[model samples]
Target: MTLNTKKDPRVAVIKTGTTYPDIKSRFGDFEAWFIRALSGNLDITVVDVAAGETPDAPGNWDGIVVTGSPAMVSDRESWSEATADWLAQAVAECVPLLGVCYGHQLLAHAFGGEVGYHPDGRETGTKQVERLAASDLDPLFANLPRTFPAQLTHRQSVLRLPPEAVLLARSAFEPHQAFRIGQCAWGVQFHPEFTEAIMGAYLDVQSPELTREGLDIDRLKAELAPAPEASGLLQQFSDLVLQMKKD
Candidate 1:
């Protein structure tokens, strides 16, 4: 898609965590995954917030994306809390924002929503996510089918949505799978940047935990598939940013 913009939209990717050493050695880290998924239309900058990197003010960028993290939102670590504050400010400024996995929970926590460990336990592997009727009005999710596959691996979730947040999607294992706050900010519990290979690596790394939790690793591995629709969100979001810039 061609954007009618005089300049490329500036997008900031807030990096919250790194992948496991093994995964990193093979598939690169979260920022690399996001960059690949987002493609090359916009000028992307990655801020490693997990490493105490402080980004500029929210208005400086045309768009923002917060990546998944191994760290839990409930921990409220100094860097995490500070990044949450930054995200809240970005939302207040009405900047287009997308948060995935831990970033999703952090967005909820930033806006007075409750987030914690799910009583039903962790959800991992390729799973189907059903878009709610409310998604019909959402720019990012509106064109997606009612149900589509997405890669997921998380133990904590947004238990309650923030005031004025619209529920967007849900899965069998996660009720709060996706939500949007105000108009420009959205959070998704699933990983839009993960590919089939990345999911397989994750499954292999978490095999012991899956076994201990009584989840069938073999089944999850068997069910692995590419989720093009879910992964397309990054480019859609990038297009949105460029369109907004054009306007």
Candidate 2:
């Protein structure tokens, strides 16, 4: 049965980079993950910026989601920089947006926040994320428990939040785990679309580096558990988009 019979809200997924070839073969690409994570509820379109696809006009889509990337925001790639400018314009227009992982860092940089290598280093594996008190009142995050677990793998983080950004969540390793800008834009440092298999695949590929960093690879793998609550955030965000279309 169709979950949304009314005209579904249109959402664009800005593909920043492709997934690891092995991972892509297994789970499709970033856009596939997002579509599945949201349970195919919204009318989704994909814009692969890495391949030179331009984002849809601001008036075209009801909302946008920026996918995580292997490239660092600090690298200042031309395409990446251009996407940031577009995001700034989208925010100015009050378009609902969700940025994940590298997308999260890029959102911060686009709005005057600092992004760089974490002071301590990479944060990989499933970890607890604490929703800040401010999240309690957020239209999307409200009523969520104070803490939840999510899959994460990143060497860079948002070291400083953007001006006027409302912080929404945090973890011991990532202080700016989540934040909101304007009334409808959000950035999450964790991967709400990542499944346990994907998380394990990441850990497997980074085993050498993780071991060298004094992280227990086996323990990290052992601690892996499903983060259903974390994945639900995507559904909530999509619902917010639907609500926005109504108003």
Candidate 3:
């Protein structure tokens, strides 16, 4: 429940949206997934920013994580915009931050980058993501392999990264799969928190729409596998936060 009194990093997880009813019943919501992935070493708090929950100032926390959402960043809803503003401040304060999916797009938007629906449409299921040469210099991604499988399900994406953002990784369909701003802020388009089962459930729930969109559901389901490397990023982030707090 706690780490060393002064050493434990206080982390706030900003929940942007809820998962499907079935998914929530089976695997819990977006925040739960992130908590599980991040593990329990760090002190973590969930803030439902989508529901008007305002979190403490970014400086109060040692680290911050923005969870993926069913909501689209392109809509720029009042709450989403407000959260973006808060994230901007978090970035300014140099908080150790990781934004996933919707969070990724929101971060880019907050930094004046462009976010919109992918021209090629939604990218779903497990896919191979390749790290760019720039990742070798990135603290969070430096040790990762050149290519790895990662879970993904997104319609909107960070079509353009912030001027100062460094491209970290990319998939065949998504050029902005992962990027980092400054030293501590990161945004990943892939769902590092998603397990194989969760990815399968997502495909099942979106089967009708996928079919209508001309995707082969069976093929996607069959390709589901554990993405250990991708999932491990959460723990790596926890380690980074803890180390930062110690300093």
Candidate 4:
């Protein structure tokens, strides 16, 4: 469907990777989870940048959500430049954003932050995220628990942030787990949209890689522990984009 389908502001979801062969793909899970969390309120547009389609009219989109990709942000891939350019324009347009996993690194990279491969390889587990707010609180963190369970299955991370970006959350494994650029824009290294069951199936199917990397399967599964209120954060994400359009 086109953006004209709804009067509600459209949200553009940038998909930067291919679907998985063995199990549910990152994009597959994300769309299902995000749509469910959004409750079919806003119109959703997806741009498959990996397939070489650059997004249009950042100002037209109420907000942007960049999805996780298997590719590294530092890699000189064609899609990297395309998505980065859209990010810069979106920044200028002041469009809200939610960047997940590799999306977080891409946001950092586009805005002059650094990203690199973690020497420790990858941390594929459920981890606790601590809010490191500099102010009294952020609207996004309004009702969020002081400490909550989040699934983090990533390797590369933002070594630093853009001057305009603010750190919102962190974990022991990464200093920049979540950040906000300007206002209405957010990037989280952890997968707030990932459900435990989906993660469990994913880990089981990806056992070969887990075994090769010597990752603790138990820890990873545990990290995906139940979060009854986790959907609240995802809903907040879609809400932010819709609200930005009112301005």
RMSD of each: 3.4, 3.1, 2.3, 2.3
The residue pairs found clashing in candidate 3 are: none
Model 1 Cα shift for residue 120 (angstroms):
1.0
Total backbone collisions for each predicted model: 0, 0, 0, 1
Query: Cα deviation in Å at residue 71, candidate 1?
Result: 0.4
> Model 4, poorest ten-residue lDDT window?
22-31
lDDT of all the models against the reference?
Answer: 0.92, 0.89, 0.92, 0.75
Per-residue accuracy of model 3 over 1-247 as CA lDDT, tens digit each: 1122433579998989899999999999888898888857777888888888889999999999999998999998999999999999999998999999999999999999999999999999999999999999788898999999999999999999999999999998999999999889999999999999999999999999999999999999989998999999999998899899899
Q: In model 4, state the lDDT of residue 70.
A: 83
Per-model TM values vs. the true structure? 0.96, 0.95, 0.96, 0.90
Tens digit per residue, CA lDDT, model 2, 1-247: 1123435687888899988888888889888899887736578778888788897777677888999999999999999999999998999999999999988998999999999999999899999999999988898788678888899999999999998999999998889999999998999999999999999998888898899999999999998989888899898988888888899
Q: How well is each residue in 1-247 modelled by candidate 1, as lDDT tens digits?
A: 1122335688889999899999999999899899888858788888898887888899998999999999999999999999889999999999999999999999999999999999999999999999999999899999999999999999999999998799999998898899999999999999999999999999999999999999999899999999999999998998899899899
Q: How well does candidate 4 score on lDDT at residue 112?
A: 90
| Residue 50, candidate 3: C-alpha displacement in angstroms | 0.6
Flag regions of model 4 displaced more than 4 Å.
1-4, 25-29, 228-230
- Report model 1's TM-score to 2 decimal places: 0.96
Q: Is candidate 2 or candidate 4 better by TM-score?
A: 2
